[model samples]
Target: MKKYSYQKCTAIVLAFIMFFSLFAGVNQAKAEAGLNVNADGAILVDGETGKVLYEKNADSPLGIASMTKMMSEYLLLDAVKHGKVKWNQEYSVSELVYKISQPTSLSNVPLRRDGKYNVRELYEAMAIYSANGATIALAEVIAGSETNFVKMMNEKAKKLGLKNTKFVNSTGLNNKDYHGEQPQGTGADEENVMSPRDVATLAFHLINEYPDVLKTASTPMKVFREGTTDRIVMKNWNWMLPSLVYGYKGMDGLKTGTTDFAGYCFTGTATRDGKRFITVVQNAKDSSGKNDGYKARFGETKKMLDYAFSNYTKEELVAKHYQVKGHKTIPVIKGKEDKVKIYTKSAINMVIPNNEKDNYKPVLVLDKKKVNKNGEVTAPIKKGEKLGYLTIEPKNGDKVSFLTEEGQKKVQVDIIAVQDVEKANWFVLMMRSIGNFFGDVGHGISSTVKGWF
Candidate 1:
């Protein structure tokens, strides 16, 4: 009874101490994102792993403002790649673009009456300056109209596996132009809106599919000729481009957008020593008396980047010519052998933040039975193909465990097919000389008869 009493007293005291410490640990500055981050629907994701490094309100659907221009650029760029539009192609700004810009939406690049701009100029302007008019022009140049272009945007979003996103306009002005979460919701706006995850996925894909998009977006300054007038200097809205912090400034490009609902949002990225990434922040105070909104953004990003640099490291989780996570061997149909050791498609690596204990080892996981091997995917299997998974946490029954970073595609593991000599040795001689004698006679008789005829 005395031991139980003592134990209960100790537990009560410890609970009190923990409860107090919890509130004590709350940093007044870091706890609240503040006007610098009004209501962040943000994400700091590893560009390579598609893993969430940090998140705030990441799942909630919020206004995206001019960020929707990313989607417009995505489709327009697709059009250009597919020969639907030309960089030098000109599109006369339509009346609707002018009418749409009249709202209190983001409009750094308003169009003039009968004004014209090339597809490249519009893309540059929209990507760098979050120009509403330029985005509309680019979309029109590709889809011939905003409505049709928006449909394409939604379709593309669906294809990209963006489940919690929808597009209602070329430019991302959410209040009126973008609809709500559903197509037939009670109310929808004219712009586009999505979570941080979808945005990151879009950004990841853009960087992977069209790396040149980064080259254009990172333009600190561009002299663009528009509408037969003096060359307009399009300065980059992404403030990170001007300076590099800890060798990561080269990743200085992408998009930025702000509105009353969306607040201030910026997707900033940089690369150092081969590592590259993007940092996104949403719902922070804009330039409206907020000094330079860039400071808070860059500050947070620098911290994340610095942590990624000082602590985390990209190491090979799986190696080429090495066995996959679980499977001992892979069935090789029509190959030289009945089966071969299935190795990781590429050298799998991960950017693990430092401070993790040295004893950390990724646990191997394989359920090859579930994967549809699509007829022996040879060397150079595509990036997202199922290449066995690893467990980040060692198994402990039903306690739960995280999966390892997805396998990467780096080393070429082209499959080598070897002929089965056993199968070849059993060749039937076609009833001995039947082919030799009969084939020769058939050919000779046909030729001789043709000559006689």
Candidate 2:
């Protein structure tokens, strides 16, 4: 009996080891499923257009984590752009900044006792490292306090049309919102939340409108106090920094974030060939709470970019509403010249939504006479001027309108009547008494001569 008991106990122990081994492997695999590493939501979109190429739970409001800093960066850049702040200006870190840097929050720029730094250095530190303390310091530097800065953030959000996003704090640090401050705790007291679509839209404007902001965001590393012994150097947190695939050529830089409630989130832009694309992934489960599901984000972003480049194309759109190839000159009366030029004014282009070269047609909307009733074109129609319009319409009925593709200076059209040409009219000649009298005299003389002969 004792020998049988020992055999059974050994068999149970082996089974237990095998079970955990498989379980650990499964957990690790889930964390690396690049597609399944799991986010409450994810999205891939065209940076040029808001068209969603791939979306999973796109509209759901989830913790954006430090992707919130993008907004702060935008507002800060706005201050610089609008002449509210200068790039070279110096600002001393206040005590508030020192207090916020105690934790490992992102944007923890090492500002010492009344640490004085240039606005440029602070910006680099905050953007490159996602330094939470640096963010707070910069906010104070710009707005005098983090509270005022958060107010500015909300205003900027509304202007960007970010309806679903809320900004309660500047650094996106843990604070309580119930007492009118950023919240911290479980999911209940969270500070910021945004949809995948809003995040991409904001990024689109940043990449397209303000390339410099993207320029700064794409920095791989920043070296402060370069030659000094205590020089601080920070590396970009985005892992896609080095190992980019064929579809991921322009894997530049962006922001990454994590917290107890927010999990891991990333907002990045990559260029393949010549096309630029943006991807946002949020609330991804850390398979073992480790390297994050970067695998899923990379795979999906590449797929999205590939789908965009392969299936979509940039089609030259030409407005074809009212266009005149060879506008004719019309004679004028009592004008600078004898005639004026009358042409059509409209543009034509193809709205290529996909890779297919679809057929197109333009609807011409012009005056019957190709000129205004008063015989004028632009403000100063010399002799002949083009004042016609061509409305472009797709055969299927969907349409877009644009100004006529025409030269800035309009050709003059004839403003006065050509009375000499009017005399050539059959009615005018028939009504001439002098010509009738001469014709009668010639007829009488011919009758007399013929009768005498």
lDDT of all predictions, in order shown? 0.61, 0.61
Tens digit per residue, CA lDDT, model 2, 159-234: 8777677777765555542233332222436567788877776776666657787677767777865786548777
- Prediction RMSDs, each to the true structure: 14.0, 18.6
The global Cα lDDT (0 to 1) of model 2 is 0.61
lDDT of 1 at 436: 74
TM-score for each of the candidates? 0.67, 0.63
Can you give the lDDT of residue 56 in candidate 2? 76
Which lDDT tens digits does candidate 1 get at residues 85-195? 888997786776766544434555666657766777777778877777677767777777766777888899888877779776777765355323222332454446788
Clashes of each: 18, 53
Candidate 2 RMSD to the real structure: 18.6
